[model samples]
Target: MVQINFAQKQVNAKIVYYGPGMSGKTTNLEVIHQRAPEPNRGDLTSISTDGDRTLFFDFMPLDLGTVAGMRTCFQVYTVPGQVYYNSTRKLVLQGVDGVIFVADSSPDMMEENLESLRNLQENLSEYGRSSEEIPLVIQYNKRDIPGALPIEVLEEKLNQRGAPAFEAIANTGQGVFPTLKALAAAVLDSLHKSSGSSVPASAPAAQPVAAPQAATAQPSAPAPAAAPAPQRQTISMSQTGFHKAPSLPLQGAAAPSEAQAPDKGARPPQNAATTPGPQALGGLQLKGGSEGDGGGLRMAQPATPPAPEQPPTQPSLSMAVPPQPPAAAPAPTQAPPATATATAKPQTPPANRPATPGSMMRPDGGSPPPRRAPASKSFPSKVQEAHATPKGGKPKSAALTVLIVVASIGLGAALGSFVLQIL
Candidate 1:
């Protein structure tokens, strides 16, 4: 599990990209790693085997400036896309703070996407998390392709649980950064909300929370565009399957208004189209935990009620404190050493005691017949004889060898010859 050190003032969260094989999961990571400011991201790692492309998930760390005077870092991951690697996928999801479902946009990939979503649910449940509670985002990748399925259909099938979804072309950085930013914002927002009112809402545009904390802050009022600030970008309507909605004019520096959110979706675009990512995904309302409070411990505060417009569902990502080891049991006390008891001197047997035919007198007063233990095998005698051979090498060795052979012969001869002698 990833741990964010509040002591250092850093908030770290894990965001996983999950979906069917070849749905551009890796591509999404590649795009984000490339576009993410160099200092904020880490190296991208991949493991390809005959069965699946990823032996282990790819990790990319993004430095989302700062929040509440703390450094916020996001580690992005992608589960192995192959279906057979479900076990590995679940392991990757173990401590996930957020999820991005990168769905294949082609109509033919529908069944695969559906199965993948199911796999995600089962795996998350195994880890005691529901897709509902966790901050979840979807990227319908491959929008640049010709035969992409309708976004509405993809959403209907994959987003029945009602999480944020984005349409993107991950290869060319189209909706990639926006998708990443949305998840990052949601993750940081969750942390702040859980951390309580001390977090600054406008920190996203400020200095980095840094390696965990160490940020400069003036405690100014939240940026006017901050609360529900929309990340802006240029877009062409034809890319979204609209036949005639005119391409949005590129405004020199205007930001998106609350009313201009993109439509719902479940995947990111597959290729490099560089169009703006979806803003609708940002509208997803997470249940409050603590940040809304003036500043409180997470344990003492309860989760805020879901918004009236959005019904409550299970959490897709949840945090479980690793069970603490039970306190060590008290060491057992050793009793004082037993006092030495004066054992009575064993009584000597009477000198005049009579010896029976099969008995012997004991040193103790009691006169008991000697008990004969059961006879041991005769092999011990032979072994003794073999060891008793003298130092004269040839004579002793020959004698010992000859004695063994003679003993065998005599053993057989005695049965017959000894019988004649006894007769």
Candidate 2:
């Protein structure tokens, strides 16, 4: 529901650090805040009640450079890590641009990590957000600890399809920036592909104060007539495994402007004032469906099943950016035989050779003699040949061949004698 203004050349993206209590979600945020350059970061804020530990959330905005021409900003938050804050956790997930499921690498915390993952899926569904389509990155936090599980096992149990996963020692800042970089990149890339933007979308600059109703509306302006609507269309859900969720009506663009402003030291309001409104047509009301549903502000009607057999096609989340294959080594060539002989046969020609006008030549550039008809003499008749056998019953042995040889010898001798006489 967060709207980023393309005209202002700024994009605002939401990234949540979600995991079980003590999984280092908050610690990851803190480390990022500490390590991030001052110009790109903001003050870290936490809200707690009854000494139950940090309950609500913490947020810090980071300004990543222009994608295309838009100024990109990442708004990062951590959800309440405790079990009692289930409602609060679900509430925070609304309008998430991307997710970083920070799992505890501790062997003992495996179950809790899994529970948190399951809860994330459930919350996403309840809020009508597709868990698969949201730009998601996995972080195995606390990887510096001894006796941690191998990253492979964690991937198998958590990331079945091999989403971008990272190993992080959030306390020491290892793998944290990579994690942020990947998610932010994915979010902007996805938005650009969807919007047909040449540049990745960026967060809009902070806007001046406006009325609440006007606050939610997109700034009114006609798009440049020269830029055509994108010709390339994304795949429809009918052709993909993704399931589409009903689009949530627009809320204010970005987190309320209070979260981003000139006053860096300003504190968050005691509570964000939320007013309930009537449900839009065709949109179902499931758990976590409304902003007010988290705090029992009001109960809406139960959801009706979407139209039969015509399931809403979900938008694709696994970006199909052209994949880069691993580099290949050059193929080794086999050297030709050192010498050639009659039996050292020529290789079979390639299957695709076209018939040439003349017979192929030998390697030495000589045209082999035109092949003659095989010199086979045919007998006049089978019976006649039988009668021609000699008195000893042995057939005449190659008479024609003997005659030919004798003639060749006599001709050679005659030519030699003539040449000697002339000399």
Candidate 3:
């Protein structure tokens, strides 16, 4: 996958170097790490076993300068090449954007090269990818070795799709950069071609050209020349499915000049009425005049209704009446003088007042009621109390003595019976 980072303004891609074991895959990465410019490369990391065989992979990040305003970064990896390490090799192929097959060109390693290429195709198939779709380059490595096979034989066996090929002695850094550069360029070009297809078909392709023109025209101020520039620019952007830029104020001013040639004052009212467009500049209102009214321009003001009139009333001599002290309320009819009739004698206690123990009245006319006893314990609590024994009491020696006597009597009766049977 090729990843585009809009926030960081960067484009990232993955490229893996794959081939048979000891085919100079690791060597190619080491040469690149050592020779690439300090600023353009990152740390070279390798995971390998004691024999220096790449156990997993080697990683090196290469930064190529900006392309179409985005920084380009290619993360390069070299997968372990041993047959038993196919699992790690498959994992390293994940999300690969490009491939560089480092074929060992010595005559002895031809079979290994073919096996590795077939393995590459199988691993890519698992990811629903095909080697034909991804950008690929081949490096015929170990070419400087004696008895190395000819380049034609290597290509026939490996470069079946006519991918770019380089004869490389990776140990001495020969052809390393050319191989890398070819793959990187292919990856970027593929990304560019792919990005083009994502654009909407309805979009106008020429809009980008107008953007540069607008940016260049920013310093000019002549109304006539500046007027058409923005109009053309807006139309181009609008056609391209881009948000239309705001119409320049100068463009509006140009309209008035063009309209001035045709009886400027009379034209405004006619245009205002007939067009029914937006209001005039500077908040001015244009209203058509009626026939009887002299057709002259007038400053308009809001209309207000006239207030109503009221009839006057005659002045009265007592309009201001003097406040009179509230009339004193009639004396509350002396409450009819409370009567002195004698009160009835106090009633005597009832003759049949019950004589209950606590109900007896004292001579002083009041007695306190007797307190009741507390309620008994619950059933469960009484059972628990009955089973509880005194903690300090001695163990039951009498029960142990009775058990011993019963056992001795049973044993003696058994012995006497056995003796009678023997006699």
- All candidates' lDDT scores? 0.48, 0.47, 0.51
TM-score of 1: 0.49
Q: Write the per-residue lDDT of candidate 1 for residues 1-423, one digit (tens) a residue.
A: 346797989878898999888787866775565345556665444433321245457665777677658887788888888787788889999889878888887888899999998888899999987876676666777665555777667766876654445565544334554455555655656655444476664544321111212112122112233521222111212332222212212222112111111221122221111222111111112221111211110000112221323211211222233444444312111111121111111111122222222111111112121111011011011222333434466788889999999999989898889889999
Q: Against the true structure, candidate 2 has what lDDT?
A: 0.47
Candidate 2 lDDT for residue 24: 63
Which stretches of candidate 2 lie above 4 Å from their native place?
49-52, 65-67, 193-423
Best lDDT among the predictions, by candidate number: 3
Query: All predictions: root-mean-square deviation over Cα?
Result: 32.3, 32.0, 48.1
**lDDT winner, 1 or 3:** 3
1 versus 2: better lDDT goes to: 1
Candidate 3 residue-wise lDDT, 273-354, digit = tens: 1221111111111111111221211111112111111111111111222454445323222122222111111111111222
Per-candidate TM equals: 0.49, 0.46, 0.46
Candidate 2 structure, TM-score to reference: 0.46
Task: For model 1, give the 10-residue run with minimal summed lDDT.
Answer: 370-379
Among residues 3 or more apart in sequence or in different chains, the pairs in candidate 3 whose N, CA or C atoms overlap within 3 Å are none
True-structure lDDT of candidate 3? 0.51
